[model samples]
Target: MRIAFYGSSLVSAYWNGAATYYRGLLRALADRGYAITFYEPDVYDRQKHRDIDPPDWCKVVVYEGTVEALKRVAAEAAKADIVVKASGVGFADDLLLQETMASAGPSTMKIFWDVDAPATLAELKAAPEHPLRRMLPSLDLVLTYGGGDPVVEDYRAIGARQCVPVYNAVDPQTHHPVPADPRFAADLAFLGNRLPDREARVEAFFVEPARRLWRRRFLLGGAGWHDKPLPPNVGYIGHVPTADHNAFNTTPSAVLNISRDSMAENGFSPATRVFEAAGAGACLITDAWEGIELFLTPGEEVLLARDGQDVVDLLAGLTPENASVIGERALRRVLAEHTYAHRASEVDRLFRNHARRVEAAE
Candidate 1:
């Protein structure tokens, strides 16, 4: 099978949050005998700060992100058996959706992968005349990274023929326990790109914990957060490289996962950090949200924090031995059930089922 995936970036995790998900899913598919062609815009500023390169399993194509460029890619993408236009491309997504759908041949399966389901669906509800209104129902499949029943229901209600949750998973081979880095060593660590919606959660979960436990050290790593005011206890390291994720997770006594506002409300939306931290065998503590236990058991495999005091209490009370046990259990669970290999196999089954349906219709 030939798969054409158009997303934010594959080689760099610069400001793009979906880079890890794209690389993990596509690389897994490639390893499973699918030939992949990834298309990204040159405007993402990621290629400049790229710390990683596309693997041999996939071919990358960069374009100027103009109407002419869209035309060129559409023609070439028509040859592929499966075409994916993921959300958060940060380019002309409306144009890309229209062009990709227009270019689709009868046999090709045009799928729209919504990495940011809450944001996308919210916009559609507020504005029904959005470009995706017409584009979505025409696509063969709609997949979301987060949001469980609500996301699926909304998509179907909005006229999507088929909608499914394709949640994020870890690539253990890429993210696993490594020796801690001295620079990142701390009592609690949080790594996430700072955005308006996420800043409040970060303050509540990450910074407030540091403030409450004044004696404990905290590490914050991400881009666009250097300007944000921080307390004396929290050490801010702007833009942690993708390659150092394991080291970052390992250095902290226990890592923290803070959801963006919408994601927390939507539930079942685990950020990439959840999987990455667990994969690195770090004792993980996250904010209270619905559907969390489905992915990681609270008492045995993970810790749930409702407020600053909860996180402070957990860090102060949790012994080294207890943290180690929790980390190990989390690693075991995600390695077994939450991995890109598992997601790739799920996609394969979905594709096979789609083929049967197409044949039946014919």
Candidate 2:
């Protein structure tokens, strides 16, 4: 199938979390012999701060941030078997959405892949006048990166024909365990960008733990955290590249996973880091979530940390033997069930099902 994705910058992970998910899923689809084109607007200074360049796996079409550019891109999209308008594209102007939707012929399937389900749903609910709400019923399918039963049910209630959750998964080859370098090795390390909505959770789970364990070496990596006050023991390393993510994960005695407020509230939403950390055979200590056990077996595969005290206690008491055991179990579980290959197959099945239904109607 020839699929075209119209969303956020696929080649840039700079400050965009969705980039990892996009790259993994698209590469997996490409491996399965699907021709893919990713359409992205050259906005938000993404080109200036790109983390990963366009890979040979997919064709990348960059558009200017204007109606004319979007119309031009939509013309190309009209030929694709599937066209996806992903959530959080940063440049999804209402005019652009309308143009893209109208340009698709009967053969083209349009999808709205919501990478940030909580925020999107919340925004729509809060503002009945939201333009995307009007666009929802017209979309062929709605897919989300995270969220469980409640999310799907809600999407249906809002008039979507179908909604699927393609949870984040690991790329085993890229994220497997490696020898820990002394530079990245720490007693405890947390990696994530700073966002206002997630700041409180970060403070509770990571910053506070660092304060509690003053004598232990701690590291924080990701963009937008330079000005934040850090304890002397906690080192701030801004923007760790995707290439070095595995090394960073492996270097930590235990890696901390902190979810944003929206994700925690929605439940069942695991970030890409959870899988990445687990894949690297790094013991994971994550803040409590509603459906964590569905992804990782707590106590055996991961340690639950509800507060700073919990984090401190876990770090101080987790023996190397126990950590290794937990990491290995988590890695095994992820490899068995949560990889890009699995997600790609699921997507293919959905596309085939949709195709079958269309044929039946015809």
For residues 277-306, what per-residue lDDT tens digits would candidate 2 score against the true structure? 999999999999999999999999999988
lDDT of 1 by residue, 11-129 (tens): 87899888889888888888889999998887868888886877888999888868899778867767888889999887888888787767777988889999999888998888788
Give the C-alpha lDDT of model 1. 0.88
Report, for every candidate in turn, its global Cα lDDT versus the true structure.
Answer: 0.88, 0.88
In the predicted model 1, the residue pairs found to clash are none
Q: On a 0 to 100 scale, what is the lDDT of residue 105 in model 2?
A: 81
Clashing pairs counted in every model:
0, 0
Local lDDT at 291 for model 2 = 94
The list of candidate 1 runs beyond 4 A from truth reads none
